[model samples]
Target: MTVPGSAPTPPDPFAPARLGPLTLRNRVIKSATFEGVTPEGLVTDELIAYHRRPAAGGVGMTTVAYCAVSPEGRTERHQIWMRPEAVPGLRRLTDAVHREGAAVSAQIGHAGPVADARSNRLPALAPGRFLSPLGMRMTRAATAEDIARVIRAHAAAARIAVESGFDAVEMHFGHNYLASSFLSRRLNHRDDAYGGSLANRAEVALGIARAVRDEVGDTIAVTAKLNMDDGVPGGFWLDESLQVARRLQEEGTVDALELTAGSSLLNPMYLFRGEAPLSEFAAVFPRPMRLGIRLAGRRFLHAYPYEEAFLLPSARQFRAALSLPLILLGGITRRATVERAMAEGFEYVAMARALLREPDLVNRMAEDRDVRSLCIHCNKCMPTIYTGTHCPLVGPLAGPPAPPLTGDGGRPRPHAS
Candidate 1:
C-alpha cells in the first residue's frame, strides 16, 4: 500500500491503519467534498464514477458528502436521500469504491435551519424560531415528537448504510446543523429537557449517536464530524465539545470524531472562506477577515491563505484529550502535511478540495513523490455545488452533471422542476 514513487526512507502513507472496527489500507482519506453528483437524492453514475476515481487514486477510504436523512433536512438539490429504495444505487457506489481497494462511508444528517425551505419547498425545522443569515424566518420549534422522528430517521439512515455496503457512517454533528444548532445557546432557547444546560444541549446528538449505534450494531463504523468551536460568541466551543466527545466515547456511541469548526449561519466563510472573494464575503460577515488587517496591511491575509489542514491544531488538541481515533480535515493538500498530521498523533488525514481538484491525487501521489496538488484553494467549487454542478477548478472533467440513477430502486424522483 506504499505510495509508488516515494522515497524508501519516507514512511508509507498508504499503510494499514485501524479505524474503529475497520482497518483502512492507509491514513489518506478522501474527505467529504460535496460533488453535487447525486441527482434527485439518489446515487447517480456520475457520483459513483467520481468516487471510484478517488478509490482508484489510492485513498484508503472515501466519504460521500452529506446524505440527508429526511428531504426537509437536505443541504442541496442533489444530496443523497437515505431511503430503502436508494440502497441499491448506494450499494453500487460502495461496491465500485471497494473494487478499487478503498473503503467507503456515508455522511448522514438533517440540514435544519441552514437549508432554504423556499428553494426546496420543505419545512425548515429548528430548536427555536430565529432569523436565518439568509434572511429567511425559521418557524416552529421541534416538538418532542419531532425530535423522536429525527432520531429515528438517523437510525434508519444508518441501517440503510449497512445494507448498502457502506463500511462506515459519519454523523454530521457540526456546522450549525440540527445537532450542532441544538448545542448552540444562541440557537436553542427552549427551556425543555432538550435545551438550556450543556447536558440538555447535547441530548439530541447523543440520542442520534445512540440510535445509529443501536441500529448498526458493531459491524459498521460510526464516526461524527464535530465542531470544536463554532467561531462565534455563545456558540459551541472546545471545552463543551471535548466534554461531549468524552461522554459519547464512554457511551460507546461513536468510534471516531472528525474535528471541524464554524457555524454556517454566523460564519459560512470560516468553513469555506477560500471560495468567496475577500471583500464580498467578508463585507457580509460580522467579524473582520483578520483582526488587524485595517491597522496592518493586506499582506497578513495573503501570507496565511486558508488552505487544507487549516484545522490541524484543533485536531491535535482533541487527539491529546481523547484516545479515540481522530481524522484531521480542512485544507489537507500535500504529502508533507499528511505526514506531519500522522506524526503529530492524528490517525488519519482527510482531503476535500484536493480530491475535487484531482480525483486521482492519491494515485498521482503514489506514483510521484514530488507531485503537488493543483487545488489553489480558490474554492470556486463551493457555489456551483448549490446548483448541482461539479468543481469549476477541475478543468473539463469538472462540473459534469450527475448522471441519473434509473430503475425503481434508484434515487427518489425530484419533486421540483
Candidate 2:
C-alpha cells in the first residue's frame, strides 16, 4: 500500500512510550505548528478538524500551538487564549482529539516584547529596554508588579487549560519569549533580583512554573519547550540553559523538557529557516540580502535542509544532567530517526514540519516499514499561515478552507467580497 507522501512507509512506529504520568500508544508526537485556524483567539471548528487529522494519524500525542496566557502579550490577536470564555471551544477540541485516541497538549505562553505592538495594539513588555534584532525599539521594561501579573496569568491559563479538558500544558520557555528573555543575559539587562545573576535571571521562569504546578496540581502534565541556545553571539547558550533546566527540575515544576534553539526575533530565519515570502509588515523592515546570506551559512543557523532527529545531541547532554523525561524536537521525519532518538535517551520525539506535509504520516509509518515523510522543509508553510493559508502539501487531503476573515473595522469577520 502506498503512503500519503509516496515514500516507503516504515514498520509500525507506534511502540508505547510514557510522558509524565501518561502512557502513550506510540513514541511519535505531532509537535506544535501554528495553523492560524482559531478565530479571535477562540477555538473554532476549523481548528478542531485541523488537529483531528493528526490524532487519527496515530501519533501518541499532539500539541496545539501557541496559546497566549495574556492577551496583551500575544503574537497574534487571533491566537487562542486560555480564558474562561474560550474554555467551551477548547473542551470541544480536547473531546474531538480524544475520540481519535491521541493525547493532547496545549502550549501556553506570553510573547512579551516579541509581540507586535502595531498588530495587537498592546504595549510590549520585556526584561529590559533593548533593540530587537527586528529593529523595533523596546518601549518598556517589566516591573515587579508586571512580573506578578504575568506569573498569575500563566497560572490562570494553566488552570483554564486543565479545566477545559486538556491532558497536558507545555510552557513556552524558548525562542526569546518572556521566560527565555529573562534567562538570557544579552536581553535581560537589569540589576534587580530577577536579573544580573544566573539565579536571578531564572527566577521568573521558576516562579511561573511553580505557579502553574500549584494551580494544576498533579492532574495535568506540565512540560516546557526550552531553548538549548538562542543561536546568536552572546545569547543564551547551552551552559546557562543547562543550569536553568537543573534548577527547574529541582523545584519539581516541570514534567518534561523539549530542547529547541534560536530566537524568533533575533533570528527568524534560523527559527523557521528558508525564505519566508515577505508579508506587508515583514517587508517594512527587511534585512539586507547579504546579512541574510551570512546568517544562513552557519550549519546550525536555519531550519531548512532538515536532518533527522536534529536536536538529539543537545537532548542527550541534558539527559546526563537530569532524570526528567526529555523531548527531542527538530527534523524528525522518519521511523529510523525516532528509534535513534529513543536509543540516544530522548523519551519522546516531536515532529512539526514533517507532520504538516502529511498529517496521516504516523499511521502510514505504523502500517508499513517503507514509508518516508514528504516534507521538503521548504518552510513555505510557516509564512503561509500568517496569511491564513492552509498547508498546501496536506490541504487537499485535509479539507476545504474555512471562511476567510474580512478586513472589517479591525474586527475579524469572514473574508467576504
Candidate 3:
C-alpha cells in the first residue's frame, strides 16, 4: 500500500519497514480497538468507514479489531464470527483500508471464559468450570471435544481471513482468553496433558498456532498478541510468557509479536490505564448489572496514571530476549516515543485511543513532528466501544452517547513486552 507522493520520511518514525510478508509505508499501526459496530456478527458500513480515515491519514496498517473464531467465542452477540458467511463483509473492510494505502490485519481470537453468557445467550466456556464475576454466570469447562473444536476454529478463521483479503491475521492470545486461560495456574486445573505443567498448559495455544501456519503458509502474516502478565495475583506472568515465545520462535508459527497484559475477566483495568469510567459503565449496563457495578465498579475498573509509551519498559524486555520483530502498544501518543521504540529495536508501535481521537494524527505528525494527540486518557472511550468505539473527547466516534455493548482472532503468535 502506497500513499500518493507523500512527504519525505522523518528521521525515524516515518521510515518504511517490513513485517513478515507485508511491507508497510511507515512504522505506525492502527491497533485493534474493538469497534462495537457489528449488529449481527456482520460488518457494517460504519465499521468500514471507521478505519478508512486512519488508513488515509497515514498508518502503515490498520487492524480490524477482534473477530471471534466461532459464535461460542464471541464476547457479545453482535461480534463477527469467523466463518465462510463472514467473508463478504470482511472483504469490504479490507478493501476499504487497502484503497487508502494501508495493509489490513484481522485480529482473530476466542474470548473463552471472558465470553459473556448473559449477552451471548449461551453458556460461557473455560478451561475449568468456574463462575465469572464479569458475566455473573456459571461457566462450562471445555471437554476434550470442545478443546479440539476451538483449535480447528482458529485455523478455519485464518483461511477465511485470507479469502476475505486480509494481509495479516493477529492471533489473540492475551487478555485471559481461551489460550491465555490455559496458561493461568488459577484457571487451568485439568489433570490432562493440556493442563498440568507450564508447557502442557501452553499446549492449546501452540497447537492453534501450528494449525494456522499449516493452513495459510505465507499468504498472510501471522501475529500473536501474547500476555506478559495477567495483572491478577495468581495469573500468567512474564517469566512463563518468555519461555512460550521461545517455543513459538523455534516452531516458526508466527511472523511478529504484539505484547499485551491484563485479564478481561479480572484486573481488566490493566490494559488501558487512566481514570476508570465507573459512572459511565454503570449507566451503560442493564438494571441487573447496574447495582453490582455501582457497588464494586471501582475494583473492576481501577485507575492508573498515564505515561507516554507506558508499555516501553515491558516491550523492551521482549526485545532484549528475542530476535523476532515486536510491536509496542499502550500510551504511544507521540513521534518521539515511536522514534525511541525504533531506535531500541522495536519494529512498530500500535495506537488505539490516540488514533480514535484523531484519525488524521499520523498525517499531522508527518507534516509536523511536534504534534501531540488530544486524548486525555480519561478512558471514557472504553464504554463507547459497545456503541461503536467512538472517541468522546473529540472526532466522529466521540460525543455519540454510548449505547450498550452491543462492545464487542490468531495465530501461533508468541508475544512479548
Candidate 4:
C-alpha cells in the first residue's frame, strides 16, 4: 500500500518499516556512493570497515556503491565486480553489516561509456558512439550482442548478490550509466531497436529489471535507483521518467524506486549541490585533465546551492504519480527534513553526504532527538573517491578532525549535539 499524501501522523524515522521481501528497522537507507577502499575489485578490510561503520551507526540498509556486473563495466579497476571469486569477500562484508543490525544491499551497475579508459584501462561502451570526457577517447556504441551480454551480466550479478548474502539489490538506472545512458535522448542517438523513441530507450531498463527479478525471485528484495530528471536540458526529464517508473511498476520487477537527478556525465553538480571543489577535483586528475580543469573548471564543477531535502520538491511529483514506495535522495541532513519527507508521503529517505559526514548521525539523532548533520556540502568529498571517500571535517580518511565524531571508529563526542 502507498503512503498517503495527506500527512498521516508524522512517523518516527527510527521506526521499522517493510521494504519488499525484507523489513528494515527504519526508513533510512545509505545511498550508494563510491568507496575508494577496494583494490583489484576485491573487498578489503577498509572497504568492509567503510560500510560496516555505517551499518553499526544505524541505517535501515547500507548499499555498497557502484558494483560492476563485469570487469569492463566498472568505472575504475578497484570497483567490485560480481563473480564467484568475489562472493566470499562480499559474503564477509554483508555478514559484518548484518551483525551490526543493518541489512546490506549491493548497487549493481555498468559504467558503460562512463568507464574511464585511462584509469580502468578499458574502452568505454554506450548506446551510441561519442567522445568521452573522462576516457579521453571515442566510445564504442554497443552492438546488439554487447547489449544482450550486459543485460545477462546484470542477471548473473544478481545471482552473485544473493549468494553473497545481500538482503536486497539495487539496479543503478541513473547517473548516465549503462541503463541511464539509454534513457538520455541526448546520449542515445542510435536508430536501432534499443534507441530513438522513449519506449525503445526504456526497453533495456525494463529488460534488466525483469531479468534480475527472474534471477533473485522472492529470495531478496529488488530496488531501482532511477532518474527523475537528468538535470540537463536535453536529457531525460520528469515527464519521460514518470512513464518509465509507471512501466517498471506495471512490470512487477522493482519493489521500490529511489528517485535521483542529474547526470554524472553532464551536470554532476545537479546531483550534489553546494560549493564545487574545483581545485581539489582538478588535483585528482592527471596532467592532461588537470590542464583542462584549469581552463574549464568552472563549467565542469558547476555550483548549485545546498538545501536540506533538496530532492523533495522534484520527488513529490513522483509521489503523487506512483504507488510504489519512493526513497528520496539528496541533501537529507537534519531530522526536520526526514520528518518533512515522511509527512509529504515519501516512504523512505536515502542519505549520502550526511551519512559520510557523520557515519553515526542516525544514532546521534536517536540519542539527542534533535542532532543535526555537520556537512557543509562543500562537495570536496566527491573528489576523495579517487583516493578515499571521506569528509574533510571528519574521519581518518581526510586527516584529523577539529573535534572527533562518535561512531565509525572515531573518538566519541558525547556533547556533539
> What TM-score does candidate 4 reach?
0.92
Looking at candidate 1, the ten consecutive residues that score lowest on lDDT are 408-417
Off by over 4 Å in 1: 1-12, 278-304, 386-389, 396-399, 402-417
306-336 per-residue lDDT for model 2 (tens digits): 4566666666789898888788887787777
Q: Candidate 4: what lDDT? A: 0.83
Ranking of all predicted structures according to lDDT, beginning with the best and ending with the worst? 4, 3, 1, 2
* Better candidate by lDDT, 1 or 3: 3
Q: Rate the local accuracy (lDDT) of all candidates.
A: 0.75, 0.74, 0.82, 0.83
> Local error of candidate 4 at 197, Å?
1.5
Is 1 or 2 the stronger prediction by lDDT? 1
> Residue-wise lDDT of candidate 3 within 1-417, one digit each (tens)?
337896433336676778888888898998888877776678888889888979988999999877899887887666788988888999999998999999999998888888877777787789899897656788899888988899999999999999999999999889888899999998989999888899999998998899999999998999999988898898998999999988889899999889889888887778888888888777876678689888988877778888998877877888999998888998988878887788788888899888888899998988888998888998887777656677876745533333333322110010111
lDDT of 1 by residue, 142-172 (tens): 8899999999999999999999999999999
lDDT of 4 at 306: 85
Error of 1 at 186 (Å): 1.6
lDDT tens digits by residue: candidate 4, 1-417: 347784258677799999999999999999898877665578877788889878888998999986899987887566788999998899999999999999999999888877765556677889888897756677889998988999999999999999999999999998888899999999999898999999999988998999999999999999999999988878999999999999999989998999998877777788888998888877765566577777797775679988888888889889999999889888888888888888888889998888888899888876785789988888878766655678867755433212212222121100000
Residue 305, candidate 3: C-alpha displacement in angstroms: 1.5
Candidate 4 residue pairs in clash (backbone atoms < 3 Å):
none
Report how far off residue 270 is in candidate 2 (Å). Answer: 2.5
